[model samples]
Target: FAKFANVNDATSHWPTGEEVFTHLPGTHAHAPLIYVALMTFILIISSVTMVLAVEAGHRMDKKAVIKWMAWTVVGGLIFLGSQVWEWSTFIAGYDGDISTWADNGTLSHSPYGGQWVMGVDAHGHEVKQMVTYGPTLYANFFFFITGFHGFHVFTGVLFNFLVLRNVIRGVYHKRGHYEMVEKVGLYWHFVDLVWVFVFTFFYLV
Candidate 1:
């Protein structure tokens, strides 16, 4: 394995790679596969339900459209809830988890108050061993990017609920347009798209 004294020396973080670097360290973290898998399924199913909603709208099946949208909204909300729980768990972790919540790192690896410990995995090492100071700047970056994604998920939950409320009131059905579903579908798909990058960066590469 090669080591870079500074992040700029790393190829993955380099400007030429900046296109993929858009998400940065977030794509590198040890993601929870179960969460990622479940989220993927939810997003795929949501898309399918959305398609059905549009078809039902075309057929003028107001009740059927409402039912499908309701399900989509439910899936989105559930995903959001799971994200919140994940964040909470990450923030509250102590033992092996990086305690970046305070930026003080007192909970895990705050060697110099603001400075966190950085560690490299030794031969045969399986866990993320920390340095006296944190897992280098990469871990910090990983947390920040994933935190942003989780925040997006959190906000998406609210948006999903709003659309669900409108659907329940038969707003889209009355308007004879399912653009609301389309809009939400766009956003949901975007989230899924982002996750695909996250999974590859964090879990695979």
Candidate 2:
């Protein structure tokens, strides 16, 4: 992972073992995996609530439909909030070594960016190791991909809210079919499915 050079490097054109930095920074205390799991759980619950809303619509139970749809909206909002927090943490990086650097007045930056380390070489001799915080492209990709998905979630929540309002207004009830609920439910489910892929690739992998 650390053997590859940056994509924009103008010097090296191949894996010459000269570049030992990764393209993505390592995880730190700020970005916990449990938070991601919680987000996933909330999204899954929201999807289930959407299903319940659709089912209630099928039975023409206006109150139940409204209730489930409201819960779904709440879940989506919570997930969006969580994503915002995650993005903030990622952007802020880790502060473990910041204080020390500040005290020295040399550099006051997160060590997650890059640093040197003392490690024993193959022959048990101490050596200075060069480490890097990873490529800027990783952050760009993280923001772009997750931000795109977050936009979808936001739109889904907005649509769900509108559908909920229509339900309360008896718009679907008058139509004698809850097809709108089902349609929005499909969109919500698709958003949830896309999140699963995003979570797996971005967080898990």
lDDT of each: 0.55, 0.68
Best by lDDT: 2
RMSD of 1: 9.5
lDDT of 2: 0.68
Q: Mind giving the per-residue lDDT tens digits that candidate 2 earns over 1-205?
A: 1211233243221211112111123443333456677789999999999999999988999999999999999999999998887676555544533211111122223556544333233121111011122343444556777899999999999999999999999999999999999999999999999999877755554
Q: Any idea how many clashes model 2 has?
A: 1
Q: Candidate 1: which stretches are off by over 4 Å?
A: 1-32, 94-129, 132-136
Candidate of highest TM-score: 2
Q: Give the per-residue lDDT digits (tens) of candidate 1, residues 123-186.
A: 2221222231123455455566677776776666677678768877888878978677667767
Off by over 4 Å in 2: 1-31, 97-135
